[model samples]
Target: MRYKGVRFCVFTLTVFKFVNGYLMTKSPPRYVDDYDNSVHSKGKFLCLFLGICSLSYHQVSTARPGLDLVYQWKQLEFDYQSEYDRQADIDMEIFIPGQPAPIDTDVYYAANSKESKVFVTIPRFQSGIPLTLGTVTDKMYKGNPVIAPYPSWSWHRSPKTCATERIVSVYRVMGQPVHSYEIPSRLLEPRSILVTPVIDIRDKQCEDTFVYIADCQTYSIIVHNAREGTFWKASDKTMYPYPNYGTFNIDGDSFDLMDGVLGMAVEPYSPGKDRRLFYHAMSSPTENFVYTSDLRNQSIFMHDPESSPHLFHVQDAVKEVMDGILPKKSRKIYEAQYDTFVKWCCQRKLENVNEDVLLVFFAEKSKTLSSSTLWAHYSMLKTMLNVKRNIDVSKFYKLSAFLKRKSEGYKPKKAKVLSLDQIDKFLLEAPDKDFLMVKTYRGERRTQSAAEAIDKNGVMYYGLMSDMKIACWNTKGEYGDRLYSDIVASDSVTLQFASGVKVVKNLKGAQELWIMTSRFQKVATDTLSSSETNFRIVAGKVDDLLFGTSCKGKKHITGGTAGGGYGLISTPRG
Candidate 1:
C-alpha cells in the first residue's frame, strides 16, 4: 500500500510539470536573443530564475533580499526614463488644482527600505512590467504618502512670475486628497511658504506651522510698485482694490516699509519658551524676527496677516548690531570703498537660545570679490534668526556711501613684496600637489611676442618679444640640454606644428614647410611638402595687439591693428 501511494504521487507531479512545460514552450520567446551576450541578458535571466523560485516558495519565504531590490530598482530607472520622456508634455500640463495626478509624482516621496522590497517582489507576480510600483500608487500605506519626489502641486507655480494656484491642499499616502483651503484674495498672495518643525509654542505643542511671505514687485517681478502694480506704502495705506506690496526702490530712498523678503528660517529647538521666526528683505540690509505663537493664530492670520502686530521686532542681540558682523577683512582689502558695504546681521539660535548662533554675512556691495565677503556673508546667515531689533537699512546704506566717498581720496599703503625665501616656502607648502611654478626671464625689454605653444612630450615653443625668434624649452621648462632656439627668416612670422609637419607662414609673403621632430622642434626642410596649401587671412591695423594663453587653456593670438584678428594654437598629442 505504501509503494502504491508513492508511485501515484510521483506520477501526479510528472504530469503537472509536463502540462506547464507544454504551455510555456508553445508561446514565442518574450525576451529577444539580440541581448544574449550583453550584461542585461544575465540580469534578465537572474531575475527570471528568482521570480520562478519566488513563485514556488512565496508562501514559505515572506522576506526579499535587499540586493535583489536594488537590482530591480536599477532596471526600473532605465524603463521609467522612456516612459517619462514620452509623457513629458502631458505631465507638465497636469499640475492644475483638482486634476488627475501624474504617474511620476512618487518621485518626490522619501525612500523607504520597506517600499524598496515591494518594488522588487510585487512585479514578479504581475503579468507585465509595473508602470507604478515601489511608488505611492501602492495604496497599502498611509500618512503623507512619502512626500512625492516631484510634488505635482509644485508645477502650478512659476517662481519667475510668482504666479501659483490660489488653493492650498494636503494629501495622505497614495495620492489620497485630504483637506484643501482656498486662500482669500484680500490677503497678500504667497510668493513662498516656509514651515517650522513641530515645537512647543503658545503653551501648546504646536505642530509644524506654515509661514507665508508676499510676492512683491522686486527681484522676480523686476519692476517698481507704481509701474508693475499696486503696492502698500506707509504714506498711503488706504485700502486699494488690491492688497499692498513691499517696495525696495533704493534710488528714491523709499525702503522704510517691508519691501521684498527673500531669506527665511525657523528655530527648531529654542531655549526660550517661545519659538522664533526670522526673515530679511532683499531690498534692505535689515533683519527682523517674530514669535511663532503670535503668527500661528488662525484668527489673527485670517483677518490681518500682513500687519504683523507687536509680535514683530527688529534684530538686536548682545548690543552687537550689524557692524559687528560685517567683514573686517574687507575694510583692509577695499581700503577706499570698504565703508560702502551694506551691513546687517540676521541672527538665529537653533540648538539653544544662546548655543548654536547663526549669523548672516554682510556684503560690501552687490559684487563679492574676496573670501572676506563670503566669510562675512555665511557667518551672518548662521546668526540671522535670533536678531531682536529692527534696523534702518536705507539710512545705513546711505551713510555708508557718504563715508566711502569721504575716504576715497586717502590712498592705502602699498602691499609689501614677498622675499625669495618667503615665496619658496609658500610654494613648498602649497595645497595643490600638481602645481609647479615656472618663471620666464625676458632680458629687460619685454618684446612684442605674438604667442606660445606646448606639446605632449613637455616641449614648449614661444616667440621672444618678436615673432621671428622661435625658442624651445625642455621638460623642466628651462633652456637646458634639449633647448633649441632659432631665428626663422620671415617678414611676418607665424608657425604651426601639426600632422607630422611644421608650417611657417609669413603674413607678408608665402608659406614654408619644415620637417618637425616628434618633440615639436622645427627642423629646416630643403623642399616644400606637396601637402602645403595657400592660407591667407586679412586682419586689423592695431599696433598694440596682444597674444597669450587664456585662463581656459586656449591661446589668444591676435594680429594687425584696430580690427584685430584672433587665432589659437594647441599642442598635439604624440
Candidate 2:
C-alpha cells in the first residue's frame, strides 16, 4: 500500500443494490455517500463486490449466513457492436471475421450501480471488449447478464485517446470528481504543514458533513471537514492487517495478493455507535468498526495527554514512556539519526525539509555505509523526522526507488551463531548443572536458537493474558506498567506462544527483540484457515529479574568520531 508501489492509476467504483433489488443506487464513483440498507421483509442479502471485477449478491439464509445462495450475477460477453462502430472511422478493423470469443470476458475495470442499471467499464487493454463503458441489463447472454453501451452507442466512437468527440476504450468514466485531500505525513508534531485527507464526504442531507479517508499505507482513518478542508489522521493504526493463515490452492496453483484498508463503509440511519464507519484491509479477514461519532469527534486526535493534561511532559523518563509509538529501547538510536539529519541541515543553512535534502543526505552516507546501514538510517529518520519535526518522508517515492537501486547488489552481514558442532562440543565438555536444563530444552522444544532477544537496558517484553497487554521488567526486578498493548483478537494471534525470538544483532548498536508468533496449535489441530489470522511478527522487549541483567549483550555504538562516523561531518552555519 505504499504510494510508490500502488502502480494502478484508476481505482475501484462501488455500486449499492438496495434491499428491494429493483432500487439500484450510484453516487460519485470515487466517494459514494453512505447508504442506509434497511433489512426488508423480502429477504436479507449479503453483497460481495470484487476488488475490481464483477458483483455477486447473496441471500443471507434464515438458517445461517452464506448457508444458501439464492442468486449470483456474472457479466457476459459483449456483442462488440460499439467497438466496431467506434473503430470504423479510424480505419481499424474492429473484429476478425468470426474471431473466437475470449474464453473468459469476466475481467472488468470498475462498476457503478445507478438507478435501474449497473454501469461497468470494460477496458480495451486487449481485444474482445466490445465497448469502453456499458450498463448491465436483465437480458442474459449465455447465463450471465449482458452489457449495453451507456448514454448511447454513438458516444464511444474513438480510440483510447479519449479525444474531443469520443470516449471509447475508457476507464476513468462514470466517476464524479471529488475534492482531493492529502494526508499530512505527521500530525503529532507541531511544525507540520497540514493538508486535506478528505476522501469521502457524507451526504449534504445529513446535518453534519464529515470527510472520511482510507490511508492504506499508514493504516489510519483520516477525517476532515468537507466545507473547511481541514483534516486529521484520525483512528491511526486502528485499522491493521491480520496475518492470513492458509493459501489459495486451486486445482493446484496457490496464490495470494496482499492489500490493506481498501474497503470502507459508513453505516446509515442509525444513532450512536450503531452509526459507524466500517472498514477492512483486503489482506485481513475481519472488518474494523468505529463509531461515526468517534471519527467525527475532533477531541480524540486533538488531545495530547503525554503526562499531564495542562503542561507538556518535559521529563525524559516520562516523555520516553508516553511520547513514543516505537520501541523505547531504540529511542537513543532514533534520536541520534534525527539529530544528525537536523545538524546537517543546520550546517548547510537549509530550511526546506523535503525529498531533495534527504536524497543528498542519504546519498553521502551511502558512500561509506553498506546498503543495510543506509536503510537503517532511512528507517530511523522516516519515523524520527515525523515524530520530532512533523515531516513525512514516505511521500518521496523517488527517494525510495533511489535507495532500492543503491541496495541492488548489497546484502546484510549475517549474525554469527554457534555451529552445531560447536554446540555439541560445548554440550559434551562444558561443566555446569545448568547445562542440563539447556540440553533438555534443546531436546524438547523445537531447538530454535534464541539469540539475545533482550535490550541493553536490562528490559524484556512479553505478552500477558486476560487483556492483550505487554508488560516490561523494571530495574527493581519486577514487572512494571505494560509498555505496549498488543492487538487483541478473538483468535489467539497474540496469545499464541512465540515460536522463535531473536535480537538480530547489529555490531555495537542498540537492538530490539523480534518475536515470531504463530498458531502451531492450529496447524497441529488442522484448524488452520485463510479466513483467520495464523501468523504474526511481533516485537517483545525482554528484561531479566534473575541476574538483574537483560539478555542483550552490552554493546554501545557511537560510530566513532565525527570524521569517522556514519556520514561526513559538516560545520554549523554562522
Candidate 3:
C-alpha cells in the first residue's frame, strides 16, 4: 500500500485516460481500447516517487510560499489481537504468509472524529501480507487490539483469476489537488528576508497572544506578536548551551546527548497576572525563564507604535543609564559594597549617607581588606551612590587622594588564559619524562561553590549545574565538559541537584567518580518545597566510564628524574 495520489485534474489523465485534460492536453481519451493499460502503468510509475496523498477536507491553495505540514496526532499500531487475526487468516489459507514478517510500510488514522479505528499498511513487498489496508479495531481479543479487513472481509475473499471484489492494492485514500501542499509562493517570495530556521513554536496566550519561536540554527529566541503579525529576536540567548560544555558521565558512560532548544513551556497565570515562559537547550542541564510581559514589550524589530516615547522623568532615565554602565557580575558586587556601607551607617545611628559616612566606611574596610580592595569599593560606590542616591562619591577629593596615595607603589596582577592551540602544543611537545609535577598547582584565583574532587593525575573533577555534569580539568582550566546529565539532574523538578563531587579511591587504589547533589538553587530562590534529605550521591568508577573521559590515562606523563616546574592548575606566580 503506497500513499500516492494523483491530483483531481490528473485523475482524468491517469484513471479516465483523458489526454486533453490538465496534463498534456490532446484529444480527450487519447488512449484507444487496450492503450488504457499502458497509460495507467505510466501514471502509476509517475506517482510512485513524487509523493502526494490528500487527506485534507478542502483543496489547499498552492499560491503561498514555503512548506506547510499537517500535525500528526498519533502513530497507528496494531494491538496483539489484530496480529492473531492475521495469523488466523493465514491458518485458514484465506491469506498467504509473507516470506519475511510483514513490514508496516505506512500508517494512517481514520479521519472520522468518532471512529476508533487505526489503519496500518503492509505493502505486498513479498507474498505473505494478507491485505493491503486493514483497520486495527477498537475490539480487543485477550486484552489486545485486533486487525480486520477495511470495508469488509468480502473485498479480500475473491480469487485472483476473475476477482473484482478482491482487495488488491491501494495507492491513496483521498482525492488530491495539484501541488496543494508543496512549497508556498509567499515563503519563497521573501527568501532573502528570512535567515533563521524555525525549530520550535510555543504560544503565550494572553489578551494579546504572542508566539515564542526558538531558532536553534542561529542560537536565537524569537517572539512573534500574533495580534500584530510581527516578530523580533529576543533574550540575547544567555541561557543557550555553552560551547565545549554538555557531555556527562553517568555510571562512567559518556554521552554527548542532544543539542539546541528542544524543551519549552509557558507557565499558567491568572487573568490579570503576568505569566512566565520556561525553556532550555535539550543538551543543557539548566533552565532559563523570562516573563511573558517582557516578551510583549517588543524591540525595534517588531513594534514601534509610539516610535519614540519621551523620557518624562529625567532622573529615572539617568538612573537606567548609570545602571547600564555596570557589568553583569559587577552589579551584585557593587550592591554588596553599598549594602555594607548602609549597615555600617545603621550601626552608628547615622541616617544620611554623605562624605563623612563614606570616609569612615572606607577607613574601616582599608584596615582589614587590601588597599586595592578599598579602591574597588571606592570605584563601585562612586557609581552605586550616584545611581541609587544621586550622590557623587567621586567629588570627595580628599578621600580619593588618601586611597590613591596608599596604592601609589602597588601593581595589580592581571589574569592570563593560554589559547587552546598553545595549550595543546605544550601538552604534546612537552614530555612527561623531562618534566615532573611534584607539587599541587596553586595559582588558581577563580572560585565556584561546587565542592571538587582531585584525581590521581592532579586533574580536579567537579559537578556543574543541575544536569549532574561531572567535569574535570588539569589545572589550567583545560576542561569544562561534563560526564553525565539527565532528568535526575534537572534543577526545577528534582531536589537532588548536582552540587559537590569527589574522586574516591578504594583500598585497591581504584578511583571512582562520586558526586553529592543538593537543592542549592531552591534555597537561593526561596522556592524550597520540601525538607527531606537534601543530598544525593552518584558514584561510578573511572576505568569503567566511556566517551574517553581521560579519567584513567597517564596524560603524556611518564616517570621523570629531573626537577620540573611547579605543576598547578593555576597560572605561574611569576
Candidate 2 residue-wise lDDT, 48-116, digit = tens: 111111111100001111011111222234444454553552355433221111111111121222233
**Model 1, residue 187: what's the lDDT?**
33
Model 3 local distance difference test score: 0.35
> lDDT tens digits, residues 1-574, model 1?
0001100000000001221121000000211001111111010000000000000000000011100000001012212234454255235632211111111110111122232211111111111222212222222111112212212434223322333321121111222222223333333223222111111222232223232222322211110121112212111111111112222111112211232433222333333234444333322323344544444433223323344333353222221222232355532333222112212211221212221111122324324444444443332322232222122232344444433453455443433333223444555665555654332211111221211222222223333322222333322222222222222222222222111111122222222122111101111111222222111111111111112111101222232223211111111110
Q: What Cα-based lDDT does every candidate model obtain?
A: 0.22, 0.35, 0.35
Question: How many Å off is the CA of 385 in candidate 3?
Answer: 19
Rank candidates, TM-score, best first: 2, 3, 1
Highest-TM-score candidate? 2
What is the TM-score of each predicted model, taking all chains together?
0.23, 0.32, 0.25
Model 1 steric clash total:
46
lDDT of 3 by residue, 1-574 (tens): 1212311111000101112221100001211001111111011110001011111110000111211111111111233245676677668754552121111211222223233222333333333445544554545443323455554565445334424443333323222222111111222222111111111123332225455544333344555554555555553443345443333222222323223442343433334333444444533433344445445545322333222122112333343333344455655576677667766775776756677777777777788978777776777777656645557676788788778777887654431323223434544566768843212112211111122333444444433342333344432221222211101112222213333233333324344343334443333223333323222323444434312332223442222212211111012110
Candidate 3 colliding pairs, count = 21
